[model samples]
Structure formats: C-alpha cells, structure tokens
Target: MSTPKMFNHKTQLILVALATVLITVFTLHANGYLRHSSEQDALYISEFSLIASVPGAQGLVSTKPADFIARCDGGYLVMDAAEKVSKNLTGVLVDQKNRLISCR
Candidate 1:
C-alpha cells in the first residue's frame, strides 16, 4: 500500500516558513534587544520606581536620571536620578504616553 502524504511540498514549505518566523520572533523577544532600555534619552516614565512621596510632586527613582524624559498632559518632565512626577500620582507610567517604544 502507498503511504499518503500528510502535506504537499508547497504546504510543507509554508509551514516551515511560518515556524521559522515564529522561532525568530520568540528568540528576539527572549533577548533584551526587543525592548527599549531606560538609558535611552527618551524613556517611558512607567519604568520608574516610586520610592517616596514629596510635596508638589511624587518621588520617583530611575537608574539613569538623564533619560527621564516623559510626556504628560502638561509637557515633558525631566527628572534627576531622584525625582518626582507632578501628576497621575497613582499610575505606574506616563499617563498618556504609556505605550513603550520597541527597541528593535
């Protein structure tokens, strides 16, 4: 009896291409290259860690102070290594600019 072919050559090629794409994507995502680093000049404020509460603005901590350029309803806020955010005291990241810039 002849064995039945599970998939045609074209189907196999398409499946292999899809698998290759998936693997590449997963590998890229696994590596940190897929994400924007906080060291970059334009950083998302959500990456900041809330350490203390201060008067006027809430305290936030970041690895690199110079990269703390985040935009809110008011404008872009520049923070030192130790800084505070004037608005959205509860949210983790920038209010409207929560979408992060993909590194790759």
Candidate 2:
C-alpha cells in the first residue's frame, strides 16, 4: 500500500465512500434484510406439508431435496385426493418479485 502522504483527496474520498456503502450493506444483512424471515419459511413448510400429505398430490417446485411446493395460478385442472381432515387453501400468494411468497 502507498504511504498516507501519497494519497490524494480524490482517492481518499472514493475509498471512504466505498467503505460506507459496504458497511451499510453489511448492517442491513445482519438485521435479516438479505434473507427470508423465519415466519415466511414456516408458512412455506406448512403448505408443503399439507400438500405432501395428500394421497396423490405432487409438488410443482422443489426448493430442497426434502421440500416441494405446489404452485397455484388458475386453470380448469381437477386433481383427486382424499378428504383431508385439516388442509384447505383458497389461493396462492406470490411475492412482489413474482416468486412463491407464502400463505402467511
């Protein structure tokens, strides 16, 4: 690295600005801004569990080896399955980015 005496005003300002932006991004990520919250994760898990319990229901999207999600848009598709004693869904929720959001 160059000596402090060799650093000019423009170079110092650029370095300071870059450092500030990096620190801001790090702080936000530390507060859970970079990933989904636990609540969203649980909602998706619950829905996947419900669908998996169905007799013949299948998952349309696999986010993990042990988890899958059934995406719902709308169509005249009729799926058959046993009468679940504790599972009912009226609609699918999506995020602003058009990805599978969750039912919470």
Worst lDDT run of 10 residues, candidate 1, spans: 86-95
Model 2: weakest 10-residue lDDT segment is 77-86
Pairs of residues clashing in candidate 2: none
List the global CA lDDT of all models: 0.54, 0.52
TM-score of 2: 0.34
lDDT of 1 by residue, 13-103 (tens): 9999999999998899898558754544453344444456667886555566543343343333433332454332322243346543222
Off by over 4 Å in 2: 1-4, 36-104
Please, what are the lDDT tens digits per residue for candidate 2 over residues 4-70? Answer: 6777899999999999999999999999888755553444323222346567776676665432224
Clashes of each: 1, 0
Off by over 4 Å in 1: 36-104
Per-model TM-score, in order, reads: 0.38, 0.34
Maximum-lDDT candidate? 1
In model 1, the Cα lDDT at residue 57 comes to: 80
